[model samples]
Target: MNVLLIGSGGREHALAWKLSRSPLLGQLFIWPGNPGTASLGENIPLPVDDHRAVSDLIHQKGIGMVICGPEAPLADGLMDFLADRHPDLALIGPGRSGARLESSKEFAKEFMLRHGIPTARYRSFGSREAEEAISFARSLGLPAVIKADGLAAGKGVVIAQTREETETEIRAMLEGRFGQASERLVIEEFLSGIEFSVFVLTNGDQYILLPEAKDYKRIGEGDTGPNTGGMGSVSPVPFADAALMDKVRDRIIEPTLRGLKQDGIPYRGFIFFGLIRVQGDPFVIEYNCRMGDPETESVMIRLESDLLQHCLDCHQNELNPGSVRVSSSHAATICLVSGGYPGDFEKGKKIEALPQTQPEEHIFFSGVSSKDGQLVTSGGRVFAVSCLGQDQLAALDQANRLADLIQFEGKYFRRDIGFDLK
Candidate 1:
């Protein structure tokens, strides 16, 4: 079937790779895709934000299915628009209303609280409540998490360790340091524990869980330094054993889907949960409506099922849990980010010594572009090197080896991506 995938990032590259391998697929197209996707299928030069243009392209091409890889367009009602324009085309993503779970943190926090989903206690505050928020933080004490209510491209949350730091964060967020994304803030109690990412493909009621993954969010090794989109990730997280996986599905995923349905927003497509394993139980840290970037690179490598078929089933609300399958092998991905990332960083720097072609080991390109026929860094996180093996250690080793082979001036990555497992 003819398929159209959206977005321009490493996650989209991985999706393209997986979908291109599906025997059910006849043709694949990626909109405004990155360099990596250009190698896999037809890279259409359609603006992601232009809804009408995208619809026209889909109709002109007779596209049968559309898979949205990122959250921005989904939150902007792309699915809703497509459904309105072409009721016959199947779209794999939540509509604008369902997207509130990711686009508005305040709404998600409140939704979780109302539905009794396991999550950190949080209080939403507007700019007028700045002083009250500071007072609330002082009451909760130090080590609080301050989050921007809206999307900020993954750089809007601050883990403040003290009252002074919390106060400063509130001021910056309210003052528009993160622009309108911080117009409202959600102060959360910091929960201590190991973090894991859980991905669920849901067709409103039925859901199929993918292998669990652990992501390194901090920019520096040893889990120190500032937060970033993601540094690296390893799949089949040891902590998410069969029992814990069941608990995640029963306690978290089920309730969330039920809640969304009760709220009149039947969610379909990928639902990502940012979870913190506190003690023996799991508490959600956040919700991402789409697949996580570097995390997807690891998870997709372990998937033994037909990626396109599963996505199509979810879109049609006919998902069969038995159809989903995953490999026993483990996978890992290390992201090579630009120098001074999660802060000020130079863009358009020339990248050299890159592998001649996409590695057979699963490499996803992120922030890169071809300028004058030369690949150059275009964003904070540039590329992801992913590998699969019998276990996490071997997978990590392969990922690191590939990472070392590619080089550019001021490129940096964490040396201890999956060290916690050791």
Candidate 2:
């Protein structure tokens, strides 16, 4: 069937690549897609936020389904709009009420608390409650966590090692450091452990689990600097064995899905469980309304199923968990960013020397566009390089090789993608 894929990023590119291989697919269209996705399908220049324009295009192209790749459009109620405008059109992703789990940290905390989901303890405060928030952080002691209640493009959460840093971050968040997105703050007790991502394709009550992945969020090597959207990711996390997954399904994922059904929240799309493994048990750190970038790149690389068919099953609430398939091989994805990324950075520099892909290696573009018929950087993150191999280290090695081959004026990438695990 004809499909409309939303957003423009590496995640969308990977999904486009996989969807293009589906025999069930007739035509694929990407909204404002990048150079990478442009190769796989038609890239329409329509803005995703313009619901009317999007509906117009859907009607024109006879698009049967829309797969949302980013959180913003979903959180904006794009799915709800489509459901109302075209009742027959298959839609992926959640509406605003369900997206609240990701858009509002305070709302997510409340949901977790109400559902008995294992998560870190948190207290919400508004702009006027800066002093109260600080007092709460002080009581939590050193290494306290301060989070902006709204989406900040993955940079809203900060782990403060000292009381001074904690106070400053809390005040900054409530004082509009991130503008309206940070008008409120969620002070959470810090939990130290290895963090990973869990993706679920759900239709309110029933769901299908995707491969678990671990991503490096900090921009620097060894995870030392400020957080970026993501640095790199590896699928089939070395530490999340069967036992841990069992705990995650029972203690976290199951409860979360049940809670959503119980609360009457309309949802049908990807749920990203940002989880941390503390002392061999899983505890949720956060949630996202859609698939996580960089993680999607690696997960797609390792998936051995017809993603389009699975997406259709999920949309129709006819998914059979036994039908899902994943490759035995490991996959890794490393991001290429502008030199001054996670801060101020320049764009539009001509990109060059991208290598040809082999059998298992792939390059997916994100913040890149064709400028005067030549590829050029368009955002902080330029693209991603991914590969499959016999093992995790081998996959990382091949992905890093591809990362090195791609060239731009100020291209920067972390060489040690899976370093901590090594």
Candidate 2 residue 287 Cα shift, in angstroms, is 0.6
Best lDDT among the predictions, by candidate number: 2
Stretches > 4 Å off in candidate 1: 356-360
lDDT (tens digit, per residue) of candidate 1 on 1-422: 99999988999999999999999898889999988899988898868999998999988988999999999999999999999999888888999988999999999999999899999888999988899999888877779789999999888888898778999999999888888899999998889898899998898898888878899989988999888999999998998888887788888999999999898996788999999889988899999998998899999989889988898888777788888799888898999999999899999988885664434386689999889889999989999989988888888888888888888878999989989987
List model 2 lDDT by residue over 367-387, tens digit each. Answer: 998977999999998988999
TM-score of each model, paired residue for residue:
0.97, 0.98
lDDT of model 1 at position 215:
91
Candidate 1 global lDDT: 0.89
Local distance difference test, per candidate? 0.89, 0.91
Cα displacement (Å) at residue 131, model 2: 1.6
Q: In candidate 1, which residue pairs get closer than 3 Å at backbone N, Cα or C atoms, i.e. clash?
A: none
